[model samples]
Target: MGLTDTPPPHVPSWVVPASGALLITGAISWDMCYVLMSIRSHRTKSYGMPLLALALNLSWELIYAARVAEHPLERLGFLVWLLLDVPLVYTTLKNAKHEWRHSPLVAENIGAVLTAMVALGCAANYAVADWWLSAPGTGFGDKSGKWWAGREGFDCTELAFWTAGLAQLALGTGCLAMLLVRGHSGGTSYAIWFCRALGTLTGWIGSTSLLWWYWPEAHGFFVNPMGIFLMTTCLACDTAYPFTLAVVRRSERVLSDGRLVSGISVKQSAAPIVKKRL
Candidate 1:
């Protein structure tokens, strides 16, 4: 999303420009991460993104591209991400059963389950977007320049903040959850982890912090109790993920067909401790 309005005079000139640069950096890094996920998905015989994260992100992209997004470039970014996500979604649908074998209810009807997820995700995102855009001074129309014009909705920046934060939370936590559930790093790799961590750092934490510092009035929620919690939680999870991944990757076996055997590398793993007879 574009700034609540291009930085005003009181704010240091470098701040907005720097924020813009960080925003672009964040976007490019995330785009690269998405591509890497698709590539890793094909190689690993498992979906690249975690199920819940994928659903949340894809839903956000879908709605933002069609409804919430305003600026031409902002809309374009969401659109590109949405289009790029199609393959990732398909890959998940195709391979999800394998990942969910332990839960027959899930594995047996993954299609239905995913369908419900997208549907619910869409409804929830749409509700919030509509609420922001339609309340009194805001009322739905093209969101471009609405806030900057001193009309209403404050560029929908708050909406973008919360949604983006939610997506990051789902993804950050979902990655580790998948690792634990699958007991391996089937769709995960060091590069994927790096890009993801970097994306959040620059995307939400980095860019957000920059803008909030520059325009505290418009971006106060960046310091909201919920916002602080969301960002902190995501950072903590991402920080711990890679080390766990390293240990798990070593123990996980890979099948010849590119399938992952359960993670259990006894040979390369640490020797187990045995208790001496008491």
Candidate 2:
């Protein structure tokens, strides 16, 4: 069983964690909406693709919330998220294709595929975790698929976890590399860089925890705690991204208007010449 299979050992005051998680989730969802609105206001109607991608992710989160309750509604919601992912991934790929036309970050585009795959694969992992959590006497060390051991159905679930974790690490690294290489005004900010670094570090280390869990030496006990820590870090990273973007935009405006040019060099401050006079 994965780390998420088990609930918190010490259930805190019922209101605190539940309310906090729900509130934070809601706020993050709102942040996505704000991102969408900002894109719409700043860019042309071409932002439809990003809005669609945002919607797809939000749908997945909705399904996730419902799934925890084991209601039939969860299945339908997840199905919708799955369907939406197809087009969303397509749009993201199309955007990357456009980006690759001018940028040499082909590897980063490939990493985008990995990101989408990992994001979607979490569903199957949750299913595995749920089954394991429901079973009895399945001690912490039990990696045996009790619910899935003898089933005639093929089990791609464990494979999903492995694939997702690897993809996540690759994507994080690819993104960091792209940021270092490209460092556009949007990309150069300390907040965005720091958040990406933290996210990548947590993801890489978390993958190691999963590796240890799969290995013969230690059991799965450490995996869950480490994974929870990593996930919370990721959630923090995602939550911070929008605010970082907002700050970047403001800074860009300041720089463009020549209102804040204290430390930059003459070359750094100079805009590129688009044409040369005859």
Candidate 3:
């Protein structure tokens, strides 16, 4: 909470007060999303977070915590996220084979795939961070953590726009695809979706917009066409997801092997529709 010895002259007094509140609210919501996903995965014996999305998330936390983030609070948050991902990742890998029945090659080699994805994710993160910090006009070392900008530069705000935006796209879109393929909400819940959707709204969209309002010159990119497209796509997917869940829930059937699948069972089938919903 210490102010910069030399603050950005253009920064308004209210920036911190407004942004900090949004940051805390978004942080709590995202943290709860992960915690709820972990509990749901264990209860239903299924994995949450699509496979590639899991790899991207785990590696993002690891790379940021270990190398990229400088602020002690930022590093601590990344570390906590990595720790929470452990059980969620483990359960997903353990139970993934059941869902991959149509693709034996993938089912047999998912662990290797995940390992490769994590390696790639780490490399991608490092490369992006290095490029962002090394660019001629952009590398100011995050002065905005305490101020606003450095010598009229972006102050690393673009990194979050790209990196965290990518994560949101992967998670929001991938989750819906997973639900469609599985035809059940075994590893997902309204709580998880609610927290995730709300977190992104408050954390990225709301707070970033507030910053834009105060500093248009450097922060205007957030409301431009490209940024608007990205944010709109994410919100659309999340909004559509819960309705999809509602439709899929009506005919949810339990398989003979104890896994939940979509569709009502036949008269001769051993599986039956599960009346209770999560």
Task: Give the root-mean-square deviation of each candidate in angstroms.
Answer: 6.4, 10.7, 7.5
Best by lDDT: 1
- Per-residue alpha-carbon lDDT of candidate 2 for residues 42-88, written as tens digits (9 for 90 to 100): 33211122322343344334434443323233344345445544543
How many angstroms is residue 195 displaced in model 1 relative to the true structure, after the best TM-score fit? 1.0
Q: Lowest summed lDDT over 10 consecutive residues: which window, candidate 2?
A: 43-52
TM-score of every model versus the real structure: 0.87, 0.38, 0.85
lDDT of each: 0.77, 0.38, 0.75
Clashing pairs in 3: none
Best by TM-score: 1
- Report how far off residue 79 is in candidate 2 (Å): 1.7
Q: What range of 10 consecutive residues in model 3 has the weakest lDDT sum?
A: 145-154
User: For residues 1-278, could you state the per-residue lDDT of candidate 1 as single tens digits?
Assistant: 65445555677878756775677677778888888888888788898687778888989988988886666667778877887888788778777877878798998888888888988999999998877776533422233333633455455666777888998999998898777667777777888888888888886788768877767765677888999999999999888998988877877888888877566533765878889998
Q: Predictions ranked by lDDT, top down? A: 1, 3, 2
Clashes of each: 3, 1, 0
Q: How close is candidate 1 to the true structure, as a TM-score?
A: 0.87
**If both were scored by TM-score, which would come out higher, candidate 1 or candidate 3?**
1
**Which is the winner by TM-score between candidate 1 and candidate 2?**
1
Off by over 4 Å in 1: 136-153, 265-278
> Tens digits of per-residue lDDT for model 3 on 83-111?
88888878778887877878999888888
